[model samples]
Target: MKKQSIKKTPAKTPVHGSKPALARQVRIIGGEWKRTPLAVLDSEGLRPTPDRVRETVFNWLGHLLDGNWHGVHCLDLFAGTGALGFEAASRGAAQVTMIEHNTPAVRQLEATKTKLNADQVQIQRSDASTWLAKTGAGTARFNLIFLDPPYHQNWLGKVVPLCQGLLADGGLLYVESEFALTDSADSVLPEWMTGWQVLRADKAGMVFYHLLKRQ
Candidate 1:
């Protein structure tokens, strides 16, 4: 019997209705790893910065970073998804330490570090306030600090002073909260936050983001 030859055809692309499901990931908006997606975990108060907000915050720090974050130390107090720290590392930060006490979130952050092979990034499974209290300014001072703790839990009040003390001269601090801190005179800042001043502020939905600088 003679054998017959069969032709091969390429697989058809799935239609819109059969599109692949989107991954639960947040992307790096700028720097070398732009658009690299980091997985998001199921954890309480794990809100990653929205792309627009992240872009705005980086743009505000453009002059400070001067296109490179080399030699800069950064701290993400409530890392959650490691978005802020990873973004800082991608932009050339010398060291980016992220602190998250939640078990699942810490695992997620570790997974991201492994996936990115981010030598500059460090994930610490510790409470934000506890870490701040233990680390004195002499021990570790950061050029940029991210204070996006779980909203409405008074975490800011607990860590603001510690973070301020840990900021180097002319260091920048980025804060995100549930309500606008600029809404009223009393809402501006606590009495001890005298050396810090808001450089930029904006609102996206209920979130109020601020970029502050230490004198």
Candidate 2:
């Protein structure tokens, strides 16, 4: 027994990928993540809603929700990191369909979805503008639709019109952009969405949130 001693084996350590996980501390400004530091993905040009803007938007729309999230569907277009949609789900939006085109952004979205356990959220990796145009005609039926496209691309013109078809009766759509809707752009909103009023327009830092009502 003294001649041969048992060998102790070292435990295996798990290794992560080449790069560490990227996360943003997103405090709920409105909806369910309110005041909570939600984990969000980060990529170049993928801007998550700032705290102040989220707070303002939520403050404006807080009354509309009225605890009616038990049966509602939401669509988040140009969903860079899927933060908005997830926030909706966390707040009780029945379902969420997230659309993001960028490869890196899409990957981050998938990662975030897993971390948040948001199985109710569906992801579609495609050009939101083209995808909506092809299948969004007269489809307005979602309880909530959000569009946060990249600046300089001018995606609002194409996406906003398409959203009218997907919004459910009296549903709300939030458009996040860098372009301010000056008097010049007022008429730019299509006549089709005449019912969708500009509920609130708030600017925080460089980001802007334009809340619309699918009247």
The candidate scoring highest on lDDT is: 1
**Per-residue lDDT of candidate 2, residues 164-193 (tens digit):** 778777888898877665235454643444
Q: TM-score, each model? A: 0.84, 0.75
Compared with the true structure, what per-residue lDDT tens digits does model 1 show for residues 35-149? 9988877567788998888988888887767876887999998998888889888888899999999998888888888888898888889988678768765578889999998
Error of 2 at 193 (Å): 7.5
**Whole-model lDDT per candidate:** 0.84, 0.74
> RMSDs, each prediction?
9.3, 10.9
Best by TM-score: 1
Give the 10-residue window scoring lowest on summed lDDT in candidate 2. 182-191
Clashing pairs in 1: none
lDDT of 1: 0.84
Clashes of each: 0, 6
